[model samples]
Target: MTSAAERPLLFLDVDGPLIPFGTSSGHRHAAASDSSASLDQGNPLLERLDPGIGPRLMALGCHLVWASTWMDDANEAVAPRIGLPRLPVVEWPDLCADAGPRGLHWKTRHLVEWASRRPFIWVDDEISAMDRIWVAAQHPAPSLLHHVDPTKGLLDDDFSALAGWLRAVAPSRVTSTGD
Candidate 1:
């Protein structure tokens, strides 16, 4: 049996993977001023979330961590709507923490350190070659930086790839049920 500590971390990003920007047919960006106001009235984008995603994610058997700009707001505003419990939130460092190579994502460095050599899956819309290279060089354990399309959110193929990688890295930590 795998211990809790043996479970790989699933660092989930909310905006792109959970709450899609808009339909695949079109993309929409809320004005800067409307951002905070929209959160107060209820983010219209949240409606785009597929409530079924939570179960599919949980079924993957990784330890889910909220790795979004939404922070605690993911637990407060997003969790209940999607049927997920309050997950551990990844506390982001200050803005200046981003001092990596040119194209490396701001979150990549922190996430690698947070994982602490444990295997992890970083699901975000912003993953790039730099991030992948950095994680490959820095993190000792296997890692997957799965990129989600903000316009489409997480698709069936995205989930399949994530599950596949998890199974490959930690076969004992996950049980395949033909999902």
Candidate 2:
């Protein structure tokens, strides 16, 4: 059973899911909508924030976390301006020992430390096939991983998908902000 205070964790990825094509034709049809920024020269994807969705996510009992390559700097810099709730940043291990060259064990490492024992949703533009496979391994009570594409940028599909998944996993979908 889940406690009332704990929100369902949402591991938000910065680049692909957050910043996408900015109403431009260049990347309009691109699947990921990734490109370099015209002004900042930083990845344009970093500039795309899903409007009015961050707070809703928080309200829906999601403890959002920064789980991107930018977890250290880039993502953090952009999150505040975008209204994403401050997050507990988690990092991946150095290498994938057992999985070998193409093992994609970073997901596995994160699973063990973070999501393996908790319920989580991964919002990334880069969740590969290996990621899904690894998630499947942890069934039952381990975790419920929801992959949200940044290109969609918090579209109804994203929220409904998340809400449904969360409803099933985190029965107590209300988080208390009692500090």
Candidate 3:
């Protein structure tokens, strides 16, 4: 088994990737109704989370880290709902000061710095071509900036892509167990 330090870091975003904000699909309405009955009353968005995603993510075998604006709140509210243990949260620098070249997402630079050349995967809704180019130029190790569809959230296809990338980057860490 690989040590946590040796594993790739999967930087996860909460709003889009976990708690999808799709209004057209009626997911929000369903979530709202569900949230009213749930214990996490503070944020109804928590209801959209699919508890099954946690296991799917864990099955990817990476060191999961919260990289969303929710920050520590994700650990407090999101983790328990989804059956995930509290993972490390990425601390953001001043968003204004850390902004990189135009078109780059504010979280891009800090995430790269946090990875510190270790292989990593960033799963978010906002990743763009500029972010990909910048990371390619700056980071030395292999990385995947997976853009999750905010409408659908983390689906099987997304999981497949993440798992495939992990297998390519660190084959030893990926097991053959089925999802």
In order, the Cα lDDT scores of the candidates are 0.83, 0.59, 0.83
Give the lowest summed-lDDT range of ten residues in model 2.
30-39
* Models, CA RMSD each: 2.6, 5.2, 4.2
Give lDDT for model 2: 0.59
- Residue runs of model 1 more than 4 Å from their true location after superposition: 1-5, 31-40, 176-178
lDDT of 2 by residue, 1-179 (tens): 45555566777766556655335454553432233222256544445565555666666677777776665553445656566656777776664346533645465456545864666677766667766666766533435455555445556676676766766667678442221
Ranking by TM-score: 1, 3, 2
Q: List ranges where model 3 is wrong by over 4 Å.
A: 1-5, 24-42, 176-178
Candidate 3 CA-lDDT value: 0.83
Q: For each candidate, give its TM-score against the true structure.
A: 0.89, 0.71, 0.87
**Where does candidate 2 stray beyond 4 Å?**
1-6, 21-23, 28-46, 96-105, 139-142, 174-179
| lDDT tens per residue, model 3, 1-179 | 23435799999998778978786656544432344344455666676789888877888888999998777877878899888999999998986694979999999999999999899999999999999999999998889999998888988888888888887778777763245
Extract clashing residue pairs from model 2: 17-150, 18-48, 19-45, 19-48
In model 1, the number of clashes is 0
State, as a TM-score between 0 and 1, how close model 1 is to the true structure.
0.89
- Candidate 3 backbone clash number: 0
